[model samples]
Target: MQQNEFAIWQEFDPHAKAWQTLNNDRSRNIARKLGIGDPSTARECLDCHADAIAPEMRGDRFQISDGVGCESCHGGSELWLNSHADSSVSHNDNLKNGMYPTDQPIARARLCLSCHMGTADRMITHRIMGAGHPRLSFELDTFTWLNPHYKIGEAWTKRKGEWNGVRDWAVGQGVAAENLLEVLTNKSAGWNGIFPELVLFDCHACHQSMSDRTWGPRQGTGLGPGVVRLNDSNILMFRHVLAPIDKAAAARILEQTRGLHRATTQSRDATFAAARRLHATIDGLLPTVAAFDYGPDSLDTILSSIEADADRGEYRDYAAAEQVAMAAQSVVVAFENDGKVDSEKAAQLRSRLDTLYATIKNEDSWSRQKFRAALAALRAAAP
Candidate 1:
């Protein structure tokens, strides 16, 4: 959140060359071409790119150039700024005074997703994407690790309490699913005239060649040929997230998700109705996922469940394949971190990891058979 998101291209390595090349210099013309160019006039552009807050709330030192500043994720500083500095004030105290509790997984996911995935109030809409905005994809742990300013060691854990990459991944998927469902069900944000928002559907589904014929059956969607399936990557990942926690619930959500896809073939009303039910299912699971402990056994379950799906031809889409690879890596590393993976197993998993990564290296060249083979190998090698 520290980088100048508007003029920025990269987040800091604590010393990344973000200031040398501004994202604004790259985006300003596009915004101008789209007719929302000026930051002074275009609040939509500033909402995600810069620290666009109310004038009354801006501190004297606050500058828009800071991009996503402390207040952007931490909340409006008016109430907690001075108090947060005092050692006597507690984290809870800061939260009580309006500081955002980013330390908590669900809360942090919600905050990061507001811009990375987008919220109704601040959407990087399909219109924006069509006009050259990059396609937004986020995995909380993956994105968080991209710009590491600190280590999560003994001192960090003491100050922040328990932290787990698997827990973060699972909670992230649930929240991401919730966010998409929220947008999908919204009257204004979810719909563009008679059609559901195109962004909610898998880009690769329609973007691929007219003669590709790569489309295949996915139990999660049940979508047939020529169908622009809704992008339920997070939803599918969320089902795996629930597997070890609540197997029955996970099974139920998967069926509901398939129903959601089927509803799309019917009518807009049917689709939204199915989406609303699935949203409630995921919403209820978030609390349990956040608080649940993820041990070696649970991590193994996650890995295997993802593999089982892929093997069954349930993850044929490029986006879903991408998510599965990430989920496997997160779960395997979490197992290794907990000292559950032996050296030989770890080495094998790493080799398989390379294979898995190689399969999805190029979205345009994504092959269901190749990805499934890589995942099967990874699952076999995983501890």
Candidate 2:
């Protein structure tokens, strides 16, 4: 009741509206059907819906109805609450006192994906979706910026650290790739009885009508029609994310990605084994992604890599193409932020960006030809 009642207070009071997305009829009904409606028994629902922390971690003022309160993303208030407020304390000190480093790329990515994607402890398997839950998808930089609670101004940089939108986006892709791989390798999470979890695969692979004819070859996956390919949108985005910083690792990831996809068609054991190898590869590159400077050169390289994917029909799946759109946004924001693009060029690119968004605006009506044309125009417009 409070989230909606205090909706107007979100501007100055983010707690009023920022995280209260779960107190709805739909969510309640879904939880009720799944026998997790009551707060006492709704651990599964509360994992993402509310600040369902350990009893010991919660303070006196803590209430589950707050729905993803400060402590959910920040940390428990008992230790760092006063420390974070003290100007004398360094950011590192706050971290030492239990504040989550939400400012960092890899840390933020993993934390967000723990619920946005899922971990073994809070797995949103195909069974959950079967119970009327929505399909989950997340873009790190996009999601963060879409409903940003704080601005990355001069003071933020001084307090936290350097802020690179594209770099964070790249690291997010790598982390998301790792999360998916973890699921594949985890028997309890990825497999239900003898069947592999369908949620791990592309939704359009089976959701689309048989007559739609969207199935085409993805060179990286090397799969033919009628195969339920893993939703490798994050893996695909690595082409752009890593190529600019580490080409050899990028190529190795591509090879491993293909192997993982092929393994799915073979056997459960093969899929898990391939996913483990790919997971290790991504895990290795994470620190590199986190530390690398995503400057103008790196941003330009990522944009060109995205254009290449569109040209080669690498975006046959809706998921991969969706990431392309988010990447374009991240790159454009970075380019404009660093004064790489003049106003005139940005104005022209705005329409091209709109076209790209329009093409994928409706997943049911997504067109490969239209998206490619839009990407081409954006590429041509960029300096």
Candidate 3:
């Protein structure tokens, strides 16, 4: 059963093929333009594309072809493999023997974000994106559901506590938000040459067509045209999570987030200061967010917040819209799972979700007006 699950995961895994694909024509073309030759063996590319480990750590049986193998996520099995087989051993004992504590939502999220959100060990820079790498985006609960290899039955829950998607989503947001600030403040990881790593900013800010002249001003920032904004998608989503439990904290976070955006148009020092303040605010909320149980009322609050943001033209940008879609899906699914939505209502909500998802399906053809309309319709149809 374990072997079958592993095969299934690997079959659909992007990480498994990262190395081979990096050597393909498309990646090579981009790499050539960026003066990166043969990314298959390039240290910069290999660090993420292939299994990155020290020479001594990789045994004779170890192969880069395994990609992100069990050891990659679960840690080296040598210490726990024998003891783990004995039924007499406790789960905690296995963990103590070097198994990763992925059963914990926050720990799992941190591990996933190390590569997905980038870290001091593996930083995804502007140059990598310039070489045609896709922008990084992660929501732990959503990703886990999409690629579930293990069933969380009673036996599973006995080993690991009850799995909560809402809790995972909330924890993920805080972790991701914290990671963004860490990268921004870190002198070595944040900067490349003189620029402040524009990749950390919204991709759509500078990627949009020159001919599209429509610019709806946001009152929150009061910023004008041609100003790059920080990618606050995670922070924005995190606010929704906080809204149900602590309205005051949510409002404060929203204010700080807007302040951070406004600071971007000013000096570098201003941006850093604003980011630090906002980061501290989010960091402080982690304990409450991790502990709070998301019930029906909580789901409603989050969904309501998402709708409010949409109405305010916050989802006009592709990055923000994408995050909104994920947030809406997460809340709706949680509501359904908790029996907050009946079968009939679930059907209706699912249809509305499909419409919302369709709006952002095609990035090139994304219409803000159409998306807003779809979102408003979804909000109206919500139970």
My TM-score estimates for the predictions, one after another, are: 0.90, 0.93, 0.94
What does candidate 2's lDDT look like per residue over 299-341, in tens digits?
7788888887777779988998888998898888887888988
- The residue-by-residue lDDT of candidate 3 on 282-339, one tens digit each, is 8899988988888767777777888787767676568778877877788778878888
lDDT scores in order: 0.80, 0.82, 0.80
Which model is ahead, 1 or 3, in terms of TM-score?
3
lDDT of 1 at 156: 49
Per-residue C-alpha lDDT of model 1 across residues 1-383, encoded as one tens digit per residue: 22233233334442223222234565766576578756434777777766678888787887776666666778887888788757677777889999998889899999889888898788878888887777888898777777655557774476579889999999999999999989988889888998778888899888888777556677777777888888899999998998898999999998999999899899878978998999989888789999999887898788878878876787777888888888877887887899987888888888888899899989888777888888888887776
- For residue 120, what is the lDDT in candidate 2? 78
Candidate maximizing TM-score = 3
**Candidate 1: what lDDT?**
0.80
Instruction: lDDT for model 2, please.
Output: 0.82
TM-score attained by model 1: 0.90
Q: In lDDT terms, which candidate is top?
A: 2
Candidate 1: lDDT of 38? 62
The 10 consecutive residues of candidate 1 with the worst lDDT sum are: 13-22
